[model samples]
Target: MSNRIYEAYVVHENDQGKYKGNIEKKRVDDLPKHGVLIRVFYSSLNYKDALSATGHKGITNSYPHIPGIDAAGVIEHSDDRRFKEGQNVIVTSFGLGENTPGGYGQYIRVPGDWLVPMPEGLTPFESMVIGTAGFTAALGVYKLRQNDVFPEDGPILVTGATGGVGSLAVAILGRLGYNITAATGKLQKKDYLMMLGARDVIHRDKVKGQSSKPLLQSRWAGVVDTVGGSILDTAIRQTKPNGAVTCCGNILGAELNTNIYPFILRGVSLIGLDSGRCLMPLRKRIWRLLANEWKPTMLEQIAQEVSLSELDGEIKKILRGDQAGRIVVNLNINAQS
Candidate 1:
C-alpha cells in the first residue's frame, strides 16, 4: 500500500497554451493526501471532464490533471473506519477532475464522505454506466416528481436527448410511464431515442430560439433541460401553468435571457441541479433511486466503453456536442479488477 505504480490519463499544458492528455505512468505517492484510496475499475465521461481535459480555466485552472468526474471501484486503503479495504464504493464530482486529481486514473484518493457505498443491486461497471450524468438525470427527475410533476400532467420535454443526461432522463421517465418528447440537434439518432422509450423525437431547431412575447403556446407540462441558454428560455415560456423545469447543463450557453412571465404569471418553477456538490444525503437518495425503481431499463444501452488511451478523440467528440450516450472508462482493461 505504501509503494505502487499505476497508469493514468494526464492532461498537460504546453508553453504554447495548448492542452494535451495522454496515458502515462504515475505513482501512488503522487496522489493527494486523503483518507480513502480507491482502486478504480470504471469511470465515465461528461462535458465538464472534456472541458477540464482541454484546459478550460473555469472547470480546471490547474494543469496536469486527470479528468474524470465519476468513479466506481474497490477501496485499496482507508484511514477512515467507515470504509475498509476491498469494499466497493462510488465517488462523483466534489471537485474531482477539477482542482483535485480525478478518476481517470487506476486509483484515486478522496475524503471518505465523498463516497457512497455501492448499492446492493449495482456493480461497479453498472454504477459507472450511470455515472454523474445518469445521477444528475435521476436527480432532476426526482426533483420534478417532488414538485408534483407526474406522468399524467402532460408530455415532458427533454432537451439534448442524445447526450448522457438527456438519454438517461428519457429512459427513466419512460419507465415511469411519462410521455417524453426528446429534442436533439442530431436528428439521425431518432431511432436511438425512440428505443430509449421516447414517445416523440423532435429536431433541436423546434426547441431553440426566443420569442418577443412573454409567453408562447404552452406545449410541455414539464421539462428536463440538459443544454441551457435560449432553449431553456424557450421551454420556460412554453411550459404549462404550474409546470416545472430542471436545468443541469449549459452546453448551449450559460446566459439565460428571459422574462418573469414564466415564473410569475405561468407559475413555472425553474430548479437548478448541481450534482457535483449536492449534499451527501441527497446523493445517497439519488443513487438509491438510480439502483432501484428509477433505474433505466435501457441502462446498458446508454454506455460504451473506452480505455484511457482512447479518450482523446472521445473528448473532442463530446466537446463538439457529438456524443449520444455515456462513455465508460475501463481503467485496467488488460488487468483483472
Candidate 2:
C-alpha cells in the first residue's frame, strides 16, 4: 500500500442547486471501513450512474458522492476471513456506487457480504465489461425462463434496444435461441440492434398504439422491458397468454397507466426487476452464469472502455440515451496497491 492519495470523480454541489462531478483527491483511509478494501481495476457506467450524477435524490441523497454502480477489482485487505488480500472480486447493485463511495474512484471498501468472488472464467477487466447492465440482462432472462418462456412461444420483445440492458438482453436471449424484436425510437440505430441478434427493430411509435384499449393483438411471447410508462403498458397488453414481462428501469416514466385486462384475461405477468436491493445469494448465482454459460460471445464488443477523466462526458451521454452499450472506467492507473 502507498500513502499517496488517488483521484476520484466525486459529485459536488454549487450554490445554484446544480450538481457537478469532478475529479478529487482522496486517501485510502478516507474510504468507509468494513468488508474488503478493493483496488478497483475497472468500473462501468449505467443509467443509475447518470441519475446520481444529475442529483437525483432518490438514487443518491448526498453530495460529493462517487458514482459507479459496477466494479471489478483485486482485494487489498479483508476484515472477513472468507475473503483475503490479493483475491479478485466483483461488486454491483448493492448500495455500491449509490449511497456508498462507489466504483468511480480508484478504491472502495464495501461489506464482504456485498462482494462476489470474481468467477473463475472471467478476468477482472472482462467481468466489468459485463458489469451491472449485463447482470441485470441475465437476471431478466432468468426471470423469463423461470416463467417458462421459450423461443418457440413467440418473439421476445426487448425495449430500449440500444441501451446497456436492452443490448445485453438481445445478445443473451439470441444466444439462448430466442427470437428477439427490439423496440426503440432511434431508427438510425436499427442496424446496430439487428447485429446484436434482434430479428427486427420496431420504432417506439409502433408500440405506443393509438387506442388505449385494454388489450391488443398478441405479438410477443415474453418481454424484457427496460423502459417503463406506455412502453411497459403496451408490452403487457401485447404479450401472448400466460406470458411474462420483466419490468425494469423507468427511463421513459415510472408510473403505469393501464387496465388489468392483460393480467386477468390473458394471464400476463408483469414482473418487477429491482437490480439494486437484489438478494445476495441470487446475485452471486447470476454473476457465476455471466462468467460462464450465460456469458455473451461478444462481451468485449459491447463495452467502450474509457479513462477516469473521460467519465464526465459519458455521464451526459447516458442521460440522453445516446451512448451505446456499457462504458467501463479504469481507475487504478494512478494508484499503487
Candidate 3:
C-alpha cells in the first residue's frame, strides 16, 4: 500500500444537485479493491465523459466521481495471474467513468478481464488517441465489412464527420481505399475532413432527409453514423441496395423515426455498435486491426494533447459540439517520475 497522494479531476454534487469539477488530491486507497491496479499514463475525453462530468443522471447516477472512459497505462499490482506488475494495458467502457471511478485519476483499479494488453506497434499516447471513440469507429467499420460492403461498391458516408468516431472511421475506411464522403454541421472544418481522407464533404442538412418518404434514392454504399435521430434515419433511407449502416452514438436523439422500406425494400442492414460491452475476442481482433491494416496515417492530426488540469474547457467544447478531434489527457505530464 503506497501512501502517495495523486492529483485527479473530481466532480462533486451539491445538496441542490448542482455539480462542480476541480483538480484535487486523492490517495491510492481511494481506488476500489479490484483485480489490478494501474498507474494510468494517458486518457482521452469522449462525449460520454462530458455527460458524466456534467451530472447527466443517465450516464452517472452518482457524483463525486472521476470521468474518463479511456485509459492506457502500466500495471502496478495484480491479483490475477494473467496480468503482472509493469505490464502495459488499456481499459475502456465496461462501466468506466460512469458508476466506477475512471481514468481522470492517475490510478485506477479494475478487474483483470476489463484490461487489454497494449498491442505491439502502438504507444500509450496512440492508444488513448484511439480510445473509445476510435474503438467504436472500428466496430462500425467491422460491421460494414461483415455485411460484405467493400470499397468498390460505392462511396462510404460518415455522419458527425468532425467528431472523434466519425473522423477515425473516415480515416480507416480511406486507408482501405474506399471512396469516403463526410457529413458535418461544421462546414469550416472542410479541410480537416478532407485531410482525414474524405473525398468529399456534404452539409449535414443534405443528409437529413427532407421528405416524409420511408426510403430515398440510394446514395451510399456503407454508412458510419455517430449521430442518431435524423442523420441515422437519413443514412438508412439513402443507403444503396444491400448496403450496411452502423449506428453507434445518439448525440442527436435516440428515436429512430424511419419506416421499414429501407430495410425490407433495399435490403439495407442497420448494425449497432457497442464498444462498451463488446466481447473480448472481438475487441482483441479490432485492436489488432487498428494497430495494423486500419491504422490511420494522420493519427497525430486527429489528436490534441492536454494536461489533466486543462480538461474543463475541452469538456465544454465537446458538449457544445465545437471540438473537432480527440483530446488526450496526459496524466504523467506533471507527475513525479
Best lDDT among the predictions, by candidate number = 3
Write the residue-wise lDDT of candidate 3 on 130-228 in tens digits. Answer: 999999999999999999999999999999999999999998998999999999999999999999899999999998867778888889999999999
**Number of the predicted model whose TM-score against the real structure is largest:** 3
Model 3 lDDT-worst window of ten: 328-337
Query: Of the pair 1 and 2, which is ahead by TM-score?
Result: 1
Q: Candidate 1: lDDT of 15?
A: 100
Residue 323: error of model 2 in Å? 1.2
Clashing pairs in 1: none
Instruction: State the lDDT at 33 in candidate 3.
Output: 67
Task: Candidate 3: list runs displaced more than 4 Å.
Answer: none
Q: What is the C-alpha lDDT of each candidate?
A: 0.90, 0.87, 0.92
- Where is model 2 more than 4 Å wrong at Cα? 1-4, 333-337
Q: Residue 306 in model 1: shift from native, Å? A: 0.9
What's the number of clashes in each of the models? 0, 0, 0
lDDT of 2 at 250: 84
Using alpha carbons, what is the TM-score of model 1? 0.97
Candidate 2 per-residue C-alpha lDDT over 128-203 given as tens digits, one digit per residue, 9 for 90 to 100: 8888888888989999999999888889999988899998999899888899999988879887788788899999
Order of candidate numbers by TM-score, starting with the best: 3, 1, 2
